[model samples]
Target: MSEQRVASPRTFPTAGEAAFREKVRGLRRWGRWGEDDQRGAVNLVTPEKVREAAGLVRLGLPVSLSRAFPVAPAANNPNPAEHYLRRRVRGEHGEGSVTDYAGVNCHGKATTHLDALCHVWNHDGMWNGRDAAEVVTGDGVTFGGIEQFADGITTRGVLLDVPAFRGASFVEWERQVTGEELDAVARAAGVEVRPGDALVIHSGREAWDRAHPRPWGAPDPDGVYRLPGLHASCLDYFHDSDCGVVVWDMMDAVPNEYGVPHCTHAAIFALGLPLLDNALIEPLAQVCRRESRTDFMLTVAPLPIAGGTGSPVNPIAIL
Candidate 1:
């Protein structure tokens, strides 16, 4: 048998440039905030929404929704987080200190991170039609960087526990989760996804990865990686439902059925939507199960990097 040709990352407009461009135009949120706005969809998280979210924290139980920051290299993390001791126990003070650093490349497959609006580009532009070349340079992104989120994200969170609904430890590897599956999970969980909610989809990918280690590089000869993730169609639901943020166990599908590798990022770019990728949703799942509730007060703060494209975040959900 001959090997099949897989789509390359640079392959423009897998669904044809004309149709993809029109789709992007239809969903694009450029000027949704204003001609010079930078916060994008997150602007939907109003003060009223935050106050409402605070009301949901009846139990005041906070559960961490982030994966352990990967500090060592692994099969999945080619460029791991770095750490150094700036000072150690010395002198009468016996003071100690350390510094930690990581590049975006350190985050892959399993790390929990937040994607800033400048993290992706579509049609050679960014959110609000900002020129990619001008906004993003070798120096770093001058606009739409993580600094836009300095005040932090505080809103109501709705967890669609797909694994729990399916009664499985994890979704099948390489499975695509679309609006249908999301609706089913939400219904089964007895929850409704409301506007301005921080929607989180849990697929149990991290648990599977921990139990089964494999060489993590390119896809297999079959053109699919052993992971589960969101399908591009999910973006429509996100936009129609007016969700402020989309958090997922994994951001992109291993190998999408549509053959459009960048569909998720492209939709995110067009819609000015921020993404929370590789979130550790299992803990949240457990907490929801224990409390018999899925809605909570979710809060996340990204590092104030003026020109950074994304940030390593530790989100918390309080019930």
Candidate 2:
């Protein structure tokens, strides 16, 4: 399939990553919050911040940014979600009430979920630079579990619509969403990625998946997962902005130009940034465009699962 490549205002990251690597070297914020900081950037979402986010709701409209759960098994979803229903039968009414249960394995290509700080690891260690073993026990993670967000995450949500900015249907492999592109999109949208903002980068993943159906996380001829994802170069932008959380429709382009594994995911380790993965962003983009604004009051409440690594979430973008 030949995609009419479009021009970008920024440089593509595929050239070389000497600068990207240097950014990674200086991106660790292990003790930035504190020695035992369970909530990394969430601390940025202070009560005052939440109140400020609430003020953004001029339209009183909400857009869901989550994908339906228990996705069927496909090339991308190896572990299909489990769902079943049951009813209490009554002679006259046939049923008193209906109940359904859903089991979701949220940490992968298929589910829209929040990634806990303990989700990823690097040579420097987990969030706050703790040892992986110290964080994860036999049963579940002892530190930085999904439950940390039980109080909920309410902040200003900013959308950086890459496809719209580039006048393309979706992000292409040749022009990955790089850090410079992020800056460009934010500037184009006339929004600043202030601290504690739920920065969402819409790479048109839903449209791209619909247009080019393939295996999830499938590697290419280069033996690397090629998806429309944020390039590794974005680490500098993320670190510099000190955004509260990093949310994306396309997570990371693996074995990126820098040859780092899940390089963009380094935000989990380096910046202590919570990552909201597999978000259904097409609707959000539409709402933003319709409303003529990209900022909204974003709220995400994680299921209170004790010791769980992460939880399936239905993130809400209230406009």
Candidate 3:
């Protein structure tokens, strides 16, 4: 089926510096957990929360929410992951050993990865106001890196299927999912966004994939087309709900009304929140539709890359 694209004009709210600052201050979680806190909003996932999430796995059905990484660079992936055989031990050295090394630029439109707290920064600093010069050095991020999530992440997953809420197969690229729409969808789906929930917003990635067929990686693609994604205002909803982690299939819309770009990242940084970008959630959406449920147990464990800004993750949803 052909995909629907939004073409209507709309303006993004809270674009001015004063308003943006207030927004940031209103939702910021800095010092909430303590100065030395590294988990950011993820600290909301307490043992009791994990117990509650476990109870949601009645069917014991686990679905992966990661996109397949491409071997060669595509039109959208300028820096595709590199995997090569590093060593092979044979003879008396060992019974048989084959080792492979992989290198990836986790933050992009192609790979499914987790953006650590240090991934985004503004004039102020990184999460908890850590000076960028001190935290992010030539070596990499010394603080708020992916190592903070080394223990792994597990929480209740809430699927906000905007397409379903809009009664469409896929929302058009020009269309942006607003915070009000997020709340409406949650109410419609009979689910509620609770504190520490891993909020996964599905903004027509399935529909776009079906229409485009090929993966995004073409040069000058931005001039060619835009992908459907959440509006910057969704951060406001996230703040109110106390979302621990925000996951999206396509990220955010481009050329928004807000003069400041990457407001999504800015809001996250202010709130000391982590983000999971470019997730594959079509199968999970289908399962949710069939079961008439939008909440499940989610697990995401990123590589323990010390001093790394982010890490590729294969998030799983267990129903």
| Candidate that scores best on TM-score | 2
Q: 249-295, model 2: which lDDT tens digit per residue?
A: 88776546654456788888778889999888899999889889989
TM agreement with the true structure for every prediction: 0.87, 0.89, 0.88
Across 1-319, the per-residue lDDT of candidate 1 in tens digits comes to 0112344535322455456567667778788789788888889999999999999989878998887777777655656776554545657887766665544442465467788888877664888888887887888888899889999999999999877887877776456678778888888878888878899888876566666545333355555443456767786777787888988875565455445445666655787788887788988888788879989999999888888888889999999
Which residue pairs in model 1 clash with each other?
A: none
RMSD of each: 4.3, 5.2, 4.6
Candidates sorted on lDDT, descending: 2, 3, 1
**Residue range 103-160, candidate 3, lDDT tens digits:** 8878877788898888877666678989888888888788899999998889999999
Worst 10 residues of 1 by lDDT: 1-10
Best by lDDT: 2
In terms of lDDT, model 1 sits at 0.75
Ranked by TM-score, top first:
2, 3, 1
* Model 3 regions more than 4 Å off: 1-22, 86-97, 213-225
